[model samples]
Target: MRKSLLLFGFALALLSCNKEQAAGGKEFKTAYVDTYKLLEESEEMKDFTNKAKVKEGELSRELQQKAKELQLDAASFESEARVKGMQWAQLKQQELQKRQRDLGIMQETFREEFDKEFGVKRDTIVSQMRKFIKDYGKKNGYDYIYGTGEAATVLYAREGYDITKKLIKELNEKYKAQASKEEPAKKEEKN
Candidate 1:
C-alpha cells in the first residue's frame, strides 16, 4: 500500500513537472542517484557499522557473562537440591526460576536497546543524505533528483543522467569534515 501511494505521488509529480516544462518553454534538468552505491561507499556508514559491531560485541559479552553465572547457579542448586529438605528444594527451585526469568528479561532488554540505537542512527543517516541531496539539487539547478536502488523505479537513464559517483564523493567529503569537526568537540568534552 505504501509503495503504491509513493508511486502514485511520483507519477503525479512527473506529470505536473512535464506539463510545466511544456507550457513554460524551459528545459528542466533531471538526474538519478544510485542509493545503494551511495550508502555502500559512504564513510560515515562504514564507521557507524563498525561502532554498531563493537556495541554488539559488548552486549554479547554481557549476555555470555550472565549465562555463565546462570550455569554456575544451576549447577550449585542441582548439587545442593539432593541433600536439602523438600521445603529448601522448593525454595531453590523458585530462586532458579526467578533467575531464568531475569535472564530472559535481560536478553529482551539488550535486543530492544540495540534495535532502538540502530534505528535512530539509520534514520539520522537517511535524513542527512536526503537533506544533502535536496540542497545539492537546488544549488546545481536540478529540477529533479531521483533515486535508484534495490527496487529501482528508473528502468533506463542515459549515460550522463546518473550522478552517483559525484554525489558519493561529495557526501563522503562532507562526512569527513563533519566527523573532523565533531572530534574536537568530543575531545574537549572528555577533558
Candidate 2:
C-alpha cells in the first residue's frame, strides 16, 4: 500500500516536471539510487550488522549457561526427591518451577531488548542515509533523485541514470570519516 502511494506520487511529480519542461523548453536532470545496493554495500550498515551479530552471540552464550545450570539443578533435585519425603520434594519442585519461569521471562526480556535496540539503530542509519542523499542531490544540482529497489519509486531508468555505485562510495566515505572522528572519543573514554 505504501509503495503504491509512493509510486502514484512519483508519477504525479514526473507529469508535472514534464509539463513544465514542455512549457519552458527546459530539461530536468534526474537520477535514481538502488536502495538495496546502497544498504548492502555501505560500510556503516556492514558495521551495524557485525556488531548486532556479536551482541546476539553474547546473549546466546549467557542464556545457554543459565540453561545448563538449570539442567544440572533439575538433575540433582530428581535424585534428592527419590530419597526425601513427599513434602520436601513438593517444595523443591515449586522452587524449580519458579526458576524455570524466571528463566523464560529473562529470555523473553533479552529478545525484546535486542529487537528494540536493533530497530532503533536501523532507523537511525536509514534516517542518516536519507539526509545524506538529500544533501548530496542538492549539492550535485539534481532535479529529482528517486530510489529504485525494494519499495521502488522508479520502475525504469536509463542505464546512465542509476547512481547507486556513486552514492554508495560517497556514503561509505562519509561513514568512514564519522567513524574516524568518533574513534578518538571512544579511545579517550577507554583510557
Candidate 3:
C-alpha cells in the first residue's frame, strides 16, 4: 500500500508540471516583409532613383562639354605652336597642361560631390523606412517583423505572414501626402 501511494504521488506531480508548462507557453504573432519589393515599389525610392539619374546625366554632360572645349583648345594650340617660336610654344604647352589639370580636378570634385549627396540621401531614406516599419509593427501589434530579400534575414515564412503589399501601399500613401505638403512650401519659396 505504501509503494502504490508513492507512485501515485509522483504521477500527480508530473501531471501538474505538464499543465503549468502548457499554460506558460504562448504563441507570438510574427510577419515578414520583402525588402526588395518594398524598395522597388515605393514611391519615394522611385523618385530618388529618377532624380539621381537626372543629376548624373547633368554632371556627365558638363564633363563632356569641358572635354570638348579642351580638345578644341589643344587643336588651336597645336596650330599656333607650329607657326610660333619655341619659347611661345613652351609657354602655351604649360598653359595647356594647367587647364588639363584643372579639368581633372573638376571631374574628381563633381564625382565626390555626387557620391556624398546620394549617399546621405540613401541613408536618410533607409532610416526613414526602418522607423516606419518599427512604428507599423507597434501600431499593428506585431511581436516581430522580419525582412526578406537579397540580404534576406527571414528565409522561410508562410505566405500569409508576408506583409510586403500592405506595407508598400501605406508607404506610398505617406510619401504622396508628404510630397503634396512639400509642393506648397516649394511654391512659396519660388514666390
Candidate 3 to truth, TM: 0.62
Model 1's lDDT to the true fold?
A: 0.81
Candidate 1 ranges with C-alpha deviation above 4 Å: 1-21, 150-191
Candidate 1: pairs in clash: none
Give the alpha carbon lDDT tens digit for every residue of 1-191 in model 2. Answer: 98788878876776566446523676766667879899999999999999999999999999999999999999999889989978989999898899899999999999999999998999999889988887877777666677867665643344456799999999999999999999999999999
lDDT of 3 by residue, 132-181 (tens): 88788777766556675655354333455689999999999999999999
Ranking by lDDT: 2, 1, 3
lDDT of each: 0.81, 0.83, 0.79
Model 3 CA deviation exceeding 4 Å by range: 1-23, 154-191
- TM, every model: 0.63, 0.65, 0.62
The true-versus-predicted C-alpha distance at residue 71 of model 2, in Å, is 2.2
Query: What are the candidates' C-alpha RMSDs?
Result: 14.2, 14.2, 19.2
Descending-TM-score candidate ranking? 2, 1, 3
Clashes of each: 0, 0, 0
Comparing 2 and 3 on TM-score, the stronger one: 2
